[model samples]
Target: DVKVTQSSRYLVKRTGEKVFLECVQDMDHENMFWYRQDPGLGLRLIYFSYDVKMKEKGDIPEGYSVSREKKERFSLILESASTNQTSMYLCASSFPLPGLAASSYNEQFFGPGTRLTVL
Candidate 1:
């Protein structure tokens, strides 16, 4: 089974402090993603890596960054934590299926999320 693991299940921080969230996937998948879940906006992608050392910024990458140093590990960094950034962070991984429609092939396996609250 494909397994994804995060560094924490819950986190609390003061505004302006640097925060780091780590994720690791047991399956050697080529794509990994980070997302934040909010009440109304739903899940918004933060960053994603398709290969080692290669990353793409998602919709809301202004306050966040990502690092993928190895195949199985992906890290998300909050440069400066803010109370507005409090949300549930999720990590997901999936294999790339060529020639297959995303709806049919790219099913992402998710990790138990980390809920972060900034005070």
Candidate 2:
């Protein structure tokens, strides 16, 4: 079975503090993504990596970054935390299927998510 796990289920940080959110997947997926969920804004992608040491900016990548030094581990970094950054951070991984449409290949498995609160 495939599983995704986050380093923490909940986190609290003060404004201007550096924050790191870690995620691990056991399924050996080729793609990993980081998203932030808010009340009304829905789920917004922060970053995604298709291969190790490769990353691409997502919709809301202003203050966020990601690292994928190993295939099974991905990390999201908040340079300096802020109150506006408080939200549920989710990590997802998916195996890429060859010869499949882009929309059909994204069968992502998600972690339990880490709820971050910045004061």
Candidate 3:
């Protein structure tokens, strides 16, 4: 079965601390994405990578960065943790469908998410 896993299910950090959120997929997907979910703002994309060593900034990438050093793993880095940065972080992976439109859709498999609390 296809599986996506995060390094932690819960994390706590102090202000100004550097945080690392790791994710791994066993499906050999071509794409990986990082998203942060907030109470009212909903899910916002932080970054995404289409291939190994290639990444693109998504909607909200200001305080966040991503690394996809290998095809099966993606990492989200928070340069300096802050209370405002606390949220649920999600990692997803997908591959383009052969018959579907490029911009239309791909079935993404998501991890359980890491709930981070910045103190």
Candidate 4:
């Protein structure tokens, strides 16, 4: 079975602090992603890595960055944490299904997220 693990389940930090959210997937998947969950906007992708040390900025990458140093591990970094950045952050990994559309590549296995609160 595929498993994804996050370094934290909940985190609290003051504004301007640097925060690191870690994710590790058991499967040797080709893609890994970080997303933030908000009420109306739903899950907004922050960053993704398709291969080790290769990353792509996602929809809302302004305050975020990602690192994929190893195949099974991906890290999300909030360069300067802010109150508005408080949200449930999710990590997911997936393999590309043959013939599946690129957007639908998110048919993935997700980790229990890190809920961050910045004050």
Per-prediction TM-score to the true structure, in the order listed: 0.93, 0.94, 0.93, 0.93
Q: Which consecutive 10 residues in model 1 have the weakest lDDT in total?
A: 96-105
Q: Per-residue alpha-carbon lDDT of model 3 for 1-119, expressed as tens digits? A: 88999999999999999999999999999889999999899889999988899998999999998899999999999999989998999999998665425722977899999999999
Q: Kindly indicate the candidate among 2 and 4 with the higher TM-score.
A: 2
Report lDDT per candidate.
Answer: 0.92, 0.92, 0.92, 0.91
Instruction: Give lDDT tens digits, candidate 4, residues 1-119.
Output: 99999999999999999999999998899889999999999999998888899998889999888889899999999999999999999999998665526746457889999999999
TM-score of 2: 0.94
Cα deviation of 96 in candidate 2 (Å)? 1.2
Return whichever of 1 and 2 wins on TM-score: 2
lDDT of 2 by residue, 24-112 (tens): 99999978999999989888999988879989898999998888999999999999999999999999999876643672367899999
**CA shift of 54, model 4, Å:** 0.6
Better of 2 and 4 by lDDT: 2
